[model samples]
Target: MTILVTGATGTVGRHVVRHLLDHGRRVRALTRHPARAALPAGVEVAEGDLTSAAGLEAAFDGVTAAHLITFGGDYRPLDNGPRIVELAERAGVRRVTVLGGWREGTLEPALRASRLEWTFLQPVQFMANALTDWAGPLRATGRVREPYGDRKSPPIDEHDIGAVAATVLTRDGHAGRSYHLTGPEVLTARAMVAILAEATGRDLRFDELTPDQVRREWVAEGRRPDLSLFRAFSEVDGAGQADLVEMLLRLYGTPNELATTVTGDVERVTGRPPRTFAQWAADHAHHFQP
Candidate 1:
């Protein structure tokens, strides 16, 4: 079976491609830039944009199952969901797995209204956020500054997210289901930093900032927020920087059941326990190295 993977070069999408290859399935990767995608050999790389499905006919042709992402460029939610779903239906694709974020996009509704079998993979947070948000601070100053140091959540590894997606796409009984994926254990920002310190052998410190302090820091950084807040507010129009920062602070500071919930769905689907933060940190320690 040839499986088409959109967002093929993204954090979770890359892992989906690799695990699908490991499953001995023929993989077709969709990317806006095939040259830059650099996916594994033997996989068909198709160049197309998810935002505009005008020229995507060839990409969807002859694909049995596919993986999709809700957001397009700059982390914005895709507004052209109906057209994409129509294209998939026309191509006779049977199954679809969508890697979605906190908020549902236009694609979810379109997928629900379609005849295709669909599953949603909702991860609470990604462990890679350490690399995205804290790596520079850890490398430069040996300190990671953020709010809600004690707010706990079980962040999933992107690799596991990919594995689950592949399993759902390739296997049956996952249709019309949504899985909340997470790591094996709960951890706070400070706890994650401690694990990173042990893994990278660096003198790392987690500095807890007040809500106002966090807002000021984001504004001082020219309001280019990190992945955590950026993805949350990507769909909000004309939202001021302070509004974005406050919303993030509220999200992190509050007690969220979804964020703190750990599920066995990863092991249930992949037949293996999810990787721990320490394991993830150890595997990616070089990214934290000076």
Candidate 2:
């Protein structure tokens, strides 16, 4: 069966494509720029935009299953959900997996009302955020300055997210389920820093930042350079960098059950335990080197 993967070049989408290829399935990757996608050989790269369903006919053609992202470019939730669902239904697609955002988007409602088999992959914070948030500082000074040093969460590896998505899309009995995916263990920012330090053999320190200090630093920097997921906060109209910074600080500083809870959904779906933060750090240690 040919499965179409949207966001085929994204962090998790690339993994999905890889796992699907490993399973020896026909994969069609949909992207706005196929030339820049750089997907693996033997996969069809189709140029299409999820925001505008008018051009997705060829991408969905003959596809039996598909993966989707709730957000479009700049992490803004896609508003043309009904149209995309209509196109998918018309194309004879049978299954779908959505990598959801922090909040529900237009796509969920449309999918819920459709006849297609659907599963939601609600993953916690991605462990890859450390590369964007801490790697630069560690490379320069061996220090990770951030707020909420004690806030805990089981950040899942992006690879597991991809694996779970691939399994759900290819298998049956996953329809109408929403899996809250997470890593195998819970850890705080400081603990994660220590793990990275061990992986890189460096004395990395976690310097906790106060809310006001984080604001000042963010203002000075003029952008939220820490995590790509924070870009989702900019989806609001007229929301500036300062607004995004505040939203991120609130999210990281505050305690939330869903953010901190560890779940076995990844292992349950993929038949293997989710990778730990230390494992992730070890694998990507070279990126943290000076």
Candidate 3:
């Protein structure tokens, strides 16, 4: 079966394409720049952008199943989400897997309203955040300073997220299911930092900051950021300084309340237990070192 993959170069999409190719599935990758898509040798790379509805016709052609994303260019929601699904429906695409972030967009509703088989993959947190939020700081100063160091979440591995998507895309019995994927256990930022210390053999530590301190730092770092407060920061972009600080306030703003819970979805879908945070740190320990 020919599977059309959008966001083929993204964190999860890269793993999805790799898993699909390893399984011998024919892949048609859609990216704005096919010349730089840099997919596997056997994969078919085509120039297509999902941000606009104009050039997706050839991407969906002759594809039985497909993978899609909720947003378009930036972190904003897709304006052409409905049109993309409509085109996929007309192209005889039977099954589809949608990779979504914290919030739902027009795409989910459009897919639900359609007759095609659809499954939504929602991952709470990515273990890769250590690299973005802490890795640089750790490498630079061996220190991680932030608010809400006690915030707890079950961060899933990007590979596991992709594997779950691969399972639902290539197999049956998962349609109409909204899976909340996470790692094997929940961990607080403090615990995660301790694990990093062990994995990297460094004297890394977490320093708790107040909300005011974090907000000031975020503003000072950026030229002019539109800072908004929320009960919870749910977007998956941990690198976003504004969102990170706000999320920290919401997380540490309260006491002993987990923003995300643990789930067995990964094991249920892939028949393997999700990887642990320590494993993630160990796997990426080389990156932590100078």
Candidate 4:
């Protein structure tokens, strides 16, 4: 099966390509710049734009299934989902796995309304998102300044997200399912910091930040958070640094059963347990070194 993996160079998408390759599936990695894709040797790097239907149509050729992101460049919403679906149907593509949600944009609705097989991979939060803030600071000073150090969450590994997507894309019985995936354990921010410190053999500290302080930090970063997108604790302007941190604080600190809960969805689908945050820390220890 020729599976077209969109956002193929992204954190999760790259792993999706890798997992598919491990399963011995033919993979076509979609990117705007094929020359710079740098995917595995066996994967086909196809130049395509998710926003442009004309560009997307060509990539759908001979593709049996697809792994697509809910949004496009700059985390922008893809409004041309129907057209993309049309092209896919025309090309006889059967199954698709979306890495986001239906409420985010028209893509999910379009996919659901289509005759094609669709599965939604909704992860609570990515463990890799920590590298965004902690990596640079740890690399420079072995410290992190963030809010809600006491806030707990079960952040799923990016690799697990990709693995689940690969399973849904290649195998049967996953269609029409919206999986709310998570790690095996719930961890507080301070606990995660301790793990990282232990993994890298360096002393690390988590300095709590007030929400106002984080908002101010966002201003200093020259990329402010868009309050309109705050429903998901998402920011449109930034890499969602402030928004996501605030979200973690809120989700874990409060009595919100949804975010702080752990589930076996990953293992249930992939037939293997989800990796823990400690394992994630060990794997990313290099980023925390002084």
- Superior by lDDT: candidate 1 or candidate 4: 1
CA deviation > 4 Å runs, candidate 1: 220-227
Alpha-carbon lDDT, every model: 0.89, 0.90, 0.81, 0.82
TM-scores for candidates 1 onward, in order = 0.96, 0.96, 0.89, 0.88
Model 3: how far residue 52 lies from native, Å: 0.8
Q: In candidate 4, what are the lDDT values of residues 1-290, reduced to their tens digit?
A: 79999999988999999999999999998899987878889998888889887678779999999998878775667888888889999999999999883248778889989999999888876898678657878788777776568777798999999999999988999999989899999888788888899998888888877867776775456444333224344424463565565555565457667778998899999999999988999999997786
lDDT per residue for candidate 2 within 1-290, as digits (tens), equals: 99999999998999999999988999999999877889999999998888887669888999999999998877888998988999999999999999998678799999999999999999988998888778898999999877889989899999999999999998899999999999999999899999999999989999998988878878776645666656667777898778778887888878898788998899889999988898899999999999
For residues 12-123, write the lDDT of model 1, one tens digit per residue. Answer: 8999999999999999999988878788989999989899986678999999899999998767788899999999999999999999965677999999999999999999
| Ranking 1 against 3 by TM-score, winner | 1
> Could you tell me the lDDT of residue 203 within candidate 2?
92
Model 4: worst 10 consecutive residues (lDDT sum)? 226-235
TM-score of 2: 0.96
Which 10 successive residues of model 2 have the least lDDT summed?
Answer: 221-230
Where model 2 places Cα greater than 4 Å from the true spot, the runs are: 220-224
